[model samples]
Target: MTRLERKCPICGKPRAAEHTPFCSKRCRDRDLLQWLEDGYALPGPPSFPDNPQDD
Candidate 1:
């Protein structure tokens, strides 16, 4: 049986067992940074301010 190869989401390189979905620490860290900096986001309705005065 042939096993399917998984590639890194960030660089398209073959994934490592240590990184799982990423090729290396750098790629993993980059993915984390993207989430931290809002480079990626989930689809959702616009949020409204709890305090109308703030708007």
Candidate 2:
């Protein structure tokens, strides 16, 4: 059986062993920056305040 090729999520380039899911340091860092700056997010319900007056 042939092995499936892994690709970088940040770019379409083939993944590097060192970076695993990313091709290079640049792509890895870029992904991290995206998370840090809230460029990525998870779906969730609206948060409610413990106290209505807090709003």
Candidate 3:
């Protein structure tokens, strides 16, 4: 197993095995809520072309 210290994106706490990238269940749930509320978003358009015929 690897040992790495990463700050949680949700609460900015130290990450652990149980949460992984999140510090705890609460932070994980908070991140999920943010995602559900559209706080996070895709940066660009879909990979496929709008018109397949054009490709």
Candidate 4:
């Protein structure tokens, strides 16, 4: 199948045109909530405001 017709990334169901990558609003909102809650994280050095190196 074409890339556009791939299954939903959230539930592995057939994707809807409206949601594009997700099957429905439920999955779409779920993904949004994950981002809002910081469910995804990127690797980075720990940042601290107390560092005194700033001049």
Q: Best by TM-score, which number?
A: 1
Each model's TM-score, in the order given? 0.77, 0.74, 0.64, 0.72
Off by over 4 Å in 4: 45-55
List clash counts for every candidate, in order: 0, 0, 0, 0
Report how far off residue 45 is in candidate 3 (Å).
3.5
Candidate order by decreasing TM-score: 1, 2, 4, 3
Q: Residue 13 CA error for candidate 3 (Å)?
A: 1.5
**What lDDT would each prediction earn against the true structure?**
0.86, 0.84, 0.82, 0.88
Instruction: Estimate, for each residue in 1-55, the C-alpha lDDT of model 2 and write its tens digit.
Output: 1223867889988888888779999999999999999999889865776787977
Order of the predicted models by lDDT, top scorer first: 4, 1, 2, 3
Tens digits of lDDT, candidate 4, 1-55? 8986699989999999988889999999999999999998778865655666773
Cand. 3 TM to true fold: 0.64
Better candidate number, 1 or 3, judged by TM-score: 1
State, as a TM-score between 0 and 1, how close model 4 is to the true structure: 0.72
Steric clash pairs (candidate 4): none
lDDT of 4: 0.88
Best by lDDT: 4
